[model samples]
Target chain A: MTTRTVARRVLTLVVRGRGAQGGVWGEAVLREFDETVTTWQALRWAAGGIRVAMRERRRRAADARRAGARWRRVSRRIVIGSATAAAVLAVLNQFVVTIAYEPSAGMQPTLRAGSRIIVDRISLHFGGLSRGDLVQISLPTPAGRISAFKRVVGLPGDQISCRDGFLIRNGVRVDEPYLPAGSTIDCRALTVPAHEVYVLGDNRAASADSRIWGPVAERDITGRVLVFS
Target chain B: MPRRPDTSPQTLLLFRALLADPSQWRYGYDLSRETALASGTLYPILIRLADREFLETRWEPPEQPGRPPRHVYRLTDAGADHARERLAAAAKPSASSKKAATAPTPRLLGGAR
Candidate 1:
């Protein structure tokens, strides 16, 4: 056989081996070898084809490493972002304020049933409760502790009475515009002792409040209603 | 697979040749001949350089009939700059500790005399 034929046979074997190994570029390398003018040059081209195969293997490995690094960076960012969002929500719930739903119409004109209200827990730290401010009070019950919303009608050391269907505070008639039209509250005279406040609901007839359970302690007040929708 | 391209003698020789004409496109066979590198050594270097973006490639159609097309390569602008900086850094000693290293050593004055 001639030198050119021997070189072609060697290159064909090499190309077939590369193809079996999944090196798709074998055809391109074989084409380049076929164009070589001499047998020596063809042998050299076959050697270059093996190097090309090795190069492709290295390139694939590098690409895999880069893809893994990119995925790790993306996962890290998601974790940090979620943690930051959760932290902001926790701080808002504890130190700032939160939304509370009024489930009953006990406070009627002041706060209707099914109304959404913003309860400001932070404001209580700066000031004491005043008469007529709507407050949330936690009362012990047989089932568990239940929270109730009502208006502060009398403060510590004040005379309070609901006589003849009208409220009297400190020997004077108390004007409560929030009461529904023609609503009447009839109860016996009672004095608000120290560290306690008299509370009443605007819907007098339907409310279960201080009139039934007596005055609530000042410490039972949790927050005051800022606004409602 | 090597994490980085091997800085063998042939690799540096090929780099010097490519750096000489950074803007000009050169063929593979021509580079192999100029650098006296075997196809086994030459192609791996070329693939590594291209992978690192230190070289760019394109295909050139045959100038005559029956001759197959071939790939050509050239260094990009950033590639050339990186090559220049790396070569310069390799050629010189680091300046950070030069002053301390070259300072005169303390000696006992006239004690042995």
Candidate 2:
């Protein structure tokens, strides 16, 4: 082939190769440069997002540190206050009392079975028991047992007895509004002991109180039933 | 000192992964796998962390006589402390919206006399 024809063929191959690769020489260079620039741009955008996130995180951390310190201070104050209150309550629960208990199922529907009660043990301590107050006393424990609980129906210097399911205290037929169903006693009449209380259960038939165990001493009394929970 | 694009997040995350295990030397591919970044995105971050003195990088021992060595990275003491700060920041709530969401209030009111 002629040298000129050979040169023309070579030129055509070069053009075709450039065309297949999809660029002019300068365009190819510019495209590569653009790609490099775009990659860096994407990275820069990602880094910017990361920077904002980091800054926000830093601010939040500072705020939380301050808040945590404040909360700790508040908690310390609360702990101190609560501890002082608890100490006062403990002293009262030890020296003075404010709770009551029933000996048996005396006032069933009104009080209930196995129900413990909180009494103003301090109230009875100041002003003594009247005609009918549900009081608790430490009865005679037959050598080896704990104290007992009962209701006071008659006080010292009173004539106490139960006739036909009704209580008679000091020549008058007393009305007991707290009696449960089927309460009946066999005692006729007896003189109350000096400085002692004649106690009985609201359910006279089921109770083993002063009628069986005799009158209770004044010092053996604990308190009266006030609140039921 | 052209700010270098504020690479604190990547630096912090890299420091965390490194401090979580100080004895083992982590490479670029290991860090990329742990942090879920592509090679194109991760290599530059590694280079930046190394430049900041937050990370130390070295050529790892070759597995065989003729095998290419891997580049390993680890966090410095300052880097670990910065990571701790970043982690603390990450654990905190971002705005008042979160506080409002968590605060409790009375559900009912007593009748007005």
Best by TM-score: 1
lDDT of 2 at B94: 68
lDDT (tens digit, per residue) of candidate 1 on B1-113: 55323345677677667877778888777777788776677777776677788889876788888776677888787666655544443333363233423432222111211
Against the true chain A, what TM-score does chain A of candidate 2 give? 0.53
Per-residue alpha-carbon lDDT of candidate 2 for residues B16-79, written as tens digits (9 for 90 to 100)? 5776775677765456557765444555565565668866766666676775455577777665
- Can you list the residue pairs that collide in candidate 1? none
Share of the reference A-B contacts seen in candidate 1: 0.42
- Backbone collision count in every prediction? 0, 1
- Model 1, range A73-189, lDDT digits (tens) per residue? 999999999999999987775657778878888989878898898888867756889999988888888898888889999998889987778999988989988888998988768
TM-score of predicted model 2? 0.37
Q: Against the true two-chain complex, what DockQ does each candidate achieve? A: 0.23, 0.02
